[model samples]
Target: MTSETALPTPASPLDLGETLTFERDGAIGILTLDRAAKRNALDDATITRLGEFFAAVPEGIRAVVLTTAGEHFCAGLDLSEMTDRDAVSGLHHSRRWHATMNAIAESAIPVIAVLQGAVIGGGLELASAAHLRVAEDSAYFALPEGKRGLFVGGGASVRVPRLIGLTRVQDMMLTGRSFDAVDAETIGLVNYRVPAGAGTAKARELAAAIASNSEVTNYAITQALPRIVESGRDEGYMMESLMAAVAQSSTEAKALMRDFLDGTGPKVRK
Candidate 1:
């Protein structure tokens, strides 16, 4: 399946303005948040660039690693931009964040977020949209909007709760409490934790494994699994069966099964 929009290749990276950059490594795409001076803060331009990348992950790109340059993953939204907007404009601005975040969450390919340093407010919301999160020991999370007399305008109110639970989210927002990488893993905010500088390697390793799976199976897992989980018991089972059938019916799936039966495929890890 070809992408309608042209994507950046390893030989030629796309110029996504000043805040975002893309690089290719085999089947995995690495999208870096480049505004490190602001601790990689999310702004209007950054969100638009992110939306462009996530909205159309071209064929051959099986997975993506959403990471940042420098110490912090992200510090949250740029407050300087917020000071000029009124209530109606603020509402529209927040919805733009929701739309960009939704594009990431609903992408066809799975995204692995590499977290380090500050993952606060909108930053935490952004990471929650990814399929998997790998946090470095230096990573920390918080929602300090309440302290600033502001509320979360991103999808944090929805996605963050689904990850760590409503109670923990409330606590963070209310008290401006921060959780380290270890605590993040314990609270279900991150899937894996590694040493301070090991996050990128770990995320790449997982992305490679995911990229090796049949695209059909990966699509089913990334797309259908969430919906099924949110569905009622009987409805969930029905959706699961349908997804299973659809995944198995793919030609690639049939070939993979044939290889497995012939003892040529890799065995399950012990």
Candidate 2:
């Protein structure tokens, strides 16, 4: 194989642009949806770049935070480009979106979404892919495709149901029910709710905590836990035990245990 093919494709930060931006804060990687003039509406380039960024997170980055500029987090797809696709083109386009969503959701590093304003339609679908979501009180959630005479094609049909419930999602679609941040939290769509303009701070805090965790522990939680939850009881239990054993046997785990036993580690206190 050629040297280029033998080595993995490296991911570099894309140019600072209206569509998207990338920056790093210590061990945490920050991804920003920058098209606030359009409420950060995603076009094909933005979606593809998102997949590339998440898929090839640098080795030093332990966690990721996804946030956006302006009042809104993301408005959704760039409907201006939502024209001119035949059925086959539409299928391929939707499949590309699925691939990107999966890349983000199954990323090696845990991801936190900092959300605000209108997280509508495809925006909601994008947020659903994160491991943790910090929602500002101003944030709103909706699935308006039913009104658009369209349907979700960005892994929403699968991932959203896993985050919330099938019936609730059904209601959102059929009735065009919009959810406030509080309602989103109540229904398990978001993990944290903060005052408007504080979503990024909260997400950074969560990402720091996640980054501090043992690598194996974080990996297991981010990767294995979901699959375990979806598996049969017997299979889940087996996989759970396997993950537990692997994590406990790591060198970092041994050191952590020693610290705790020696009373040098922080104790559990509330």
Candidate 3:
């Protein structure tokens, strides 16, 4: 797991509405899937709620820790909602999922998914949307859409591939293959792997560190960096230099630099 400092419980929970709960601990927000009965499977209401909530993440929350109740993190979309939909409706549904996933990924604040058992189908897509993922030993990932005679609707087709690569995603989808936490980590699906039930704590720790970052730095990473990667080499370098100038010009940057130069700030250490 990534190194992080521990924090106490949040002061109070925020009212983010049903199917989920929200709490703020300093600059970090804890967004939890509260649907244990369905193993946190996301129906339309839940998915819409998830998107809406994150799209307007509280100003006080600079980073997020996404977790769920029960053993399983999410079983994917509530397949029960698959009843009676024409091809056009299905297309719209898929697009809706795409929008939901995109909202999370596009947020300026970093999101960290705390993954546990049964991270499958749309569950995997949801995890992929996170900037970082912490997987517990009990966590297992899969793409069972093939067996269900359906293709992935969420942005997994695009985002997951970027993380674990297209070939591996193809292999998993084609064979309905499942990967454990360690394997997921090795494949780049998860940033950190921890013992069972330790995912949330570790993820929150990461969130705390992320929250401590300068606002401009975090915004650049969440916004400019990904776009820069997709640009041509010359364009990417130009973008990087522009961002570097803006970042260094910040008052926060000046203060931090002074601290480092004066030996007040923490130094790099193994």
Separately for all candidates shown, the number of backbone clashes (residues 3 or more apart, or on different chains) is: 0, 0, 0
Error of 2 at 37 (Å): 0.7
TM-score of each: 0.93, 0.93, 0.93
Estimate the lDDT of model 1.
Answer: 0.88
What's the lDDT of the predicted structure labeled candidate 3?
A: 0.86
As for candidate 2, its clashing pairs are: none
Q: Per-residue lDDT of 31-58 in model 2, one digit per residue for the tens? A: 8888888998889878877877776777
lDDT values for all models: 0.88, 0.86, 0.86
Deviating ranges (above 4 Å) for candidate 1: 1-15
TM-score of 3: 0.93
The TM-score between candidate 1 and the true structure equals: 0.93
Query: Candidate 1 at residue 123, lDDT?
Result: 94
User: How do the residues 1-270 of candidate 3 rate in per-residue lDDT, one tens digit apiece?
Assistant: 111111112233243458888878999988999889998898987777777776778887899999999999999999898878889788878877877787789898899999999999999999999999999999999999999899999888899889989999999999989999999999899999999978888998899888877888998999999999899999999999999999999988888899999999868889
Model 2's alpha-carbon lDDT is 0.86
| Native-structure RMSD, model 1 | 4.2
**Per-residue lDDT of candidate 1, residues 52-92 (tens digit):** 77876655899999999999999999998888789988887
Off by over 4 Å in 3: 1-15
